[model samples]
Target: MSLDKGGKNMGRMKISVAAVFMCTFIISAVPASAGTSGRSVETTLQSDLAGSLNPEGLLLTVGGYRRWISGMNEEYGIPSSYVQSGAMLGVSPAYSHVSAHVEWKPVILAQVRLQYTLFRYFGDFGALLSFPSKDSPFGKDEVDAREGQEEKDWGQRYLLQPTLTAKAGPIIIRNQSDAAYFTYNGAGPYFLEWEYDTLVKDGGWVVSNRTFLLWEAWKGPGKAALLAGTVYEITRSFSADLTRRRIGAVAVWTPAEGDGLFQKPRIYSQVGVNLEDRNRDGEVYFIIGAGFDHDL
Candidate 1:
């Protein structure tokens, strides 16, 4: 994470937020465990690609994702299923959850922006933005405000994402550093680490190879669990190895994943490079997936 390098207090905010949301979910979800005490595992794979002919002009992009989550209700000894379409909407330009943004484009490839998002499930809202920096990679930078539910945190949160991107012929390279902070009742300067994505694209073949790095800080809900043993172990173990870094690639065959069920889906795959508490790690966590992309 970029921490305080950008003057954004994001790193401090994420910590406090994590504590709050972890407790909230445990309190709310655990009680329903009656007749549901079991264990669960979930995994998801998705793909997306977008480009601007001008690179510095208005951008159009679309992508699709599919996720499968299943867990056991430790108390009731039953299984549970979870799926999120919000992940799809977040990256969708037309249907983005962003309520509004105040923006500035100082140069063709540089922009400054203030963005806000509302999470219906958590009843939380976020205020975020991005700024054009002289030292930025490709001259791009972003800052954001997220609510408790945005990242499953406790309450209000702030984030700073400093990004650098380079273009070499048909390949594009990008690196981003992310940090966040969380505050509740004006009580914290607590810091928490977060997520990032690295991508390498080949314009010539309309293909891309990418990786996603994500993690969770252990604190507030570290000890809370709905199940006594295995279920709790599953959650704790997963959370402890909270750092999730995935590497994958995709190849676009036609134009998109298809218009309907009769059409073909886009192909994508990913392997977990570093997994927490794993003896047979790296590449052991692999997923093959299909999705769609459209220009809007």
Candidate 2:
């Protein structure tokens, strides 16, 4: 996901204030998590929102997410899920505007995700686009604070996401990896490097991997099912030399077959802890959300 660029004084102040208010209210009103990126949490939620498999054709999803981490002041909440809609033709394309509020940080990211199946019921290749520096929201002080003393303005960002899935009896295993590239609004130009251990002077890359192991806990008579799973996530930022790791347990509930207003509904909850992190003070986190999709 991508955030919009920074604006002038008033605009920046307004966004900052709104973000603080939302974070405060959410903390008092709900639980919290550590310094996990809003995009990461949204990715997990979206995965669960798919229920058993990815939906086809036009689809819409609505839900809210909340997380809290122990040991730090950071907390994130989406009291209401942002605009999430997508469609799958031969190539699936989707868009989302995610508004995340933290104690001292507020970010709004707009992203388009395109995916094409590489093989039937196995794997796929995907790309994430946040284009036009003016429209994309990365490296903005109002949205994300600098991790170091140096100041820089980030421009467009892109990511290549590849996925793999396997199933055996009642268990399913899935893995998704992301390699991200960034552009900056400065003089220094950086070339793409496969070496994630090396730092770049200007733009850089972030790599992440997420894996899930799910078990079919229960099944209803119709199209309803309950799944329990464990998720492992690791993210590394080459520019900032930041690394985050988390492990959690999740449960998802899918409703029975129906053509009602809810369509294909999914309710999910997760609770996890940071196994290793140097960014945020928190250690544990919790998430609960519900969403439904409709085919066009």
Candidate 3:
């Protein structure tokens, strides 16, 4: 199913209008009586360990998540919903003011990541390696029939990510950046004219940055809290000279806090607008997800 130029323009206009309406709705939904005292209980623990030089030994964690996204299709150029489970092994050696972890997500889209935190949580760095199995659901050849080209396998993917966080009172700020490189398995100059308008000879690079501003809306009643936030993201493809920008409103609900087997269960939703996108048909996107962690 392909849309003509005029039809695509109309769809984008409608999505823009819907984005404005959704943003207004999100703003209006914030409780007027929400107080600043709703800060997360973890803040206290963070402060206590801020400058401490005590080593916490090895901490192992297992977690799983499920997420759904609106506007998920090849034409939309967005990722599809999936269920993922993973386990992480970490060590925090406070003597050097650093922490490191390794995580693995197996099957379907197999991935392995190594991450390190430096300067007492002031800076975080990570590298991820991933490749999809034959059972992977992404980039099927059938989805590319309209383009008259067989979609090559995704091949291997490498990513480097860094993040920083800061907090003041009931507000928190975070910024994360990712640089990804992809390798194609077969074919000559794989070109995604619909999405990037460029040819991928052997590999390509895509970089993006996302920033978030969140405020605690309500907290209490046994470690439950509500948070509202806004996120802005910009992405660029070095191989294609393509750029994309997005802005969104988000809300998160933490049901409880504990260090037991399963802890810090959270549910979140977001309404987003593609401020600028040369690819895809829609301007508005919606996502809802939930996840929890297990300590072993």
* Candidate number of the best lDDT: 3
Give all candidates' CA lDDT scores.
0.25, 0.38, 0.39
Give per-model TM-scores. 0.29, 0.47, 0.50
Worst 10 residues of 3 by lDDT: 47-56
Compute the lDDT for candidate 2: 0.38
Supply the TM-score for candidate 1. Answer: 0.29
User: What is the TM-score (0 to 1) of candidate 2?
Assistant: 0.47
lDDT of 1: 0.25
**Candidate 2 structure quality by residue, lDDT tens digits, 1-296:** 11223211111111111111111121121212234233422222212222110001121233233332222223323222232322221111222222231221122211122221111110111111122232222222322242222222323445555445555656756666667665544333332111221123345777877777888677664336677888887877676556768788877676664575555556666667777654232466555545554432
Off by over 4 Å in 3: 1-154, 191-201, 221-223, 258-262, 280-282
Residue lDDT tens for model 1, 1-296 = 23333522322221111111112122222222245333223222323332211011111123232323344435423233433231322321111222222333232222222333322122212212111221222111222233231222222323332333333332323333324332332122221211111111111011111222211111122222221100001111111122223333222122222344423233322223333222223433322323332212
Better of 1 and 2 by TM-score: 2
**Candidate 2 least-lDDT 10 residues:** 117-126
